[model samples]
Target: MRNLRLTLAWAAALLVAVSPLVNAQTTSEKNLKSDKKAAMSKETLPRPKVIIFDVNETLLDLAPLKSSVGKALNGREDLLPLWFSTMVHYSLVETLSDDYHSFGEIGTAALMMVAETQGIELSYDDAKTAIVTPLRSLPPHADVIEALKALKADGYKIVSLTNSSSVGVETQFKNAGLTEFFEKRYSVDSVKKFKPHPETYKMALADLGVKPEEALMVAAHAWDIAGADNVGLQTAFVARPGKTLYPNADKPDYVVNDLSELVKHLAATKTAQADTESDKTLAEQLAAQAAKSAKRFPESVRKVYAEGIETVRATQIEESAKQVGDAAIDAELTNWNGETVKLSELWSEGPVVLMWYRGGWCPYCNIQLRAMQQNLDKIENAGARLVVLTPELPEKAKETAATNNLDIVALHDNGSAVARKYGILFKLPAAIVPSYRDKLKLPEYNGNDAMELPLSATYVIDKSGTITYAFLDADYKKRAEPADVIEAVKAAAK
Candidate 1:
């Protein structure tokens, strides 16, 4: 009862709504005291600072769990929010009682309680399976994958700090196709405590060998931000419901409306920092090379080295901004697929109609594919080979092709590496994050877990890789008409 009171007190103090949970472990109470002490050890380490993440309400999606409950309760869609509140409440109860309960158990208990509250009849086993299965396989928000990729590329070490057991978090990470992005996943089971507990946050930072000041904490819950702030970690709040404003005691350093906004903000920050560092490094390298050349030859080489440095700087700037040469007319992409057909090679044989699509999840791609299918005969008779290049996983790519009933070859362009080489690769905008999640509901990129976007382009390439005709659409929804490609093919053949 004391434990329950402490748990409720903590929840009420933080204005955190919560549900009930399973019993705690034998050693949890003793462990909690040690955690506070353990967290006080602020040691700095050698590697770049690690940013610790909160998993469920942070990186991983709880929407599936909530959605399932809402459906189970017959439009009492608010059941999930209530159940989640109880889950957190019980997690604290376990910690205070010096006990540890697996997140799965706590989740089960919470679901049963929520069901009882709603006067719904569900057997313990049935309720547990319904809630836990989806929780275990919960997807990450769409923006999460891309945001992590950008951070990884920018040299930030990423880790997940969650109240879920390590096994639970692992299952979730793997299921969400997010195993690669996280350098480490720490579960509260390690400390036998949940967040708002300074020890839990401390242990995570300690393991990563980063000072709290150097680390940033991101979560969709206000309690998480407040707890993180108490322990001195900078927090970014992602406004998940029932998590109100910080209690005036702990304020987040940044409050974003959604994961998309957080991702864009982080990307811009990293980019600016990178540009600054790159400029410094470039200046130093040029100066050192110039000095070496001056020492090597007092006459001719000095001017050459100076000229080389200038050329290098100019090259960098041009490469940064220069668009690819009319991609349809030049820069023929080689086809490595075993098939004897290549996009450019086909053009010389007759005419080649190439489509650059963003893979199957895109509504625009589907609409365009159906249109292309409608004009298959016209395309073929015009002496053109139709090919679609996408960054989908091979199986998914094949499935998408089969579903579209396409006669064209669906080529795999995994990593968008081919598109990048062609200067068609661009970072996805944060604005489109919801479009991918709530709208298109696409699977993440196979390699990086980031959302994939392609500039829907159609090209007519000749046998020599020279593009004869091209269409580039800035709006992904509107594709080049099959008639347009057919006309281009006929014109090229003539």
Candidate 2:
């Protein structure tokens, strides 16, 4: 009994000694969470592949529609919003009940219901005319066109996904001059559903061939944002006049006052980390490799290599080659699997990190390819594709891919044809060409007798085919660091 009492006393003493530290840790975590929640209010969302816009009231102004509805409701313009709400409610009712009605018909019914609730006489034809006519001819919101133009120029896929019917949205867009802005316009009428229905959003994602996370639903209605959020899509809430967020719904990724402000946030280079730190750059490693390899070669051969590099530099090929801000040409090249891959097609899905390798025989090229493979995940996570081009035959490209175990795209730039277009193709040193032909078997590998090869260049091209980053060098040993390319991809996304 005495021993038990002593052990209990020890346990109590230990708890007392550690209580303060445990309390401090808990308090710190709570404060950190509090700070994070506060910061979220000012945070902007990441860029999405497709921006799905809600048409009614979100892009189009409802003031004219309101006046028309008010005239039908005995000059009670305040009842216009109520009629719209009733219309939306009935849409949900029809969807859940497995019944379908055109949005115009529902709107007409809703307006009649509102008129009856207010003890006013209304006819179906008059209500239909009031709702459909004004809704079709409604003017676009003031901030709509310029913001849409900016996004379209940036190569963002702009889609209009709305509760309005297909014919209704078509008429509306044509009348408002918005048909030119949208890549596609989808309507709930196709699925016979309402805005908050999950299937409506799913149908769009399916048709567009995009994952839910790749799309952002922008709307003025809190309920719509809630539906999109629940469906695993990022959402933006445009707090237009008289529209407020739902208190119980999850907060949207963005809460902007207008589309113009949303564009500004999307354009900010928030993810571009130019100073992203690393232990060593690929260029530095290449320098180290060059120095080490020099010991293996004779002094005469080393002198020849130096002259070749200097000679190429004198040509100023870097100035003539495609650089940043240039439009990337759609070079249709075949991959190791004999699949035709076009640069424009690749850029359509995401930003591309296009790299040129001399051949698998070069030690420096192998080193750089391995480094790029290691950083492949980082590049892809930033929403970019890594495409490695080599002036080797399709079978030789396969060998290189197998040798390095490279799982990403490896393409054959047959005959250095694509390289010539990029202005990076150059003749080899006359002294070394004979030895390279015999020793490296360059002619057999590339299926050409021309002693020409492209520079070890790298470029990052955005979805619009605009080159956002380029690395050109005469020295074959040097390469663009993968970390910098990843940063460039992130910047290109903005």
Best-fitting candidate, measured by TM-score?
2
**Please, what is the whole-model Cα lDDT of each candidate in the order they appear?**
0.64, 0.81
lDDT of 2 at 447: 87
Worst 10 residues of 2 by lDDT: 269-278
Task: Show where candidate 2 strays beyond 4 Å.
Answer: 1-46, 269-494
Worst-scoring 10-residue span by lDDT in model 1: 39-48
lDDT of prediction 1: 0.64
What TM-score fits each model? 0.46, 0.53
Compute the lDDT for candidate 2. Answer: 0.81
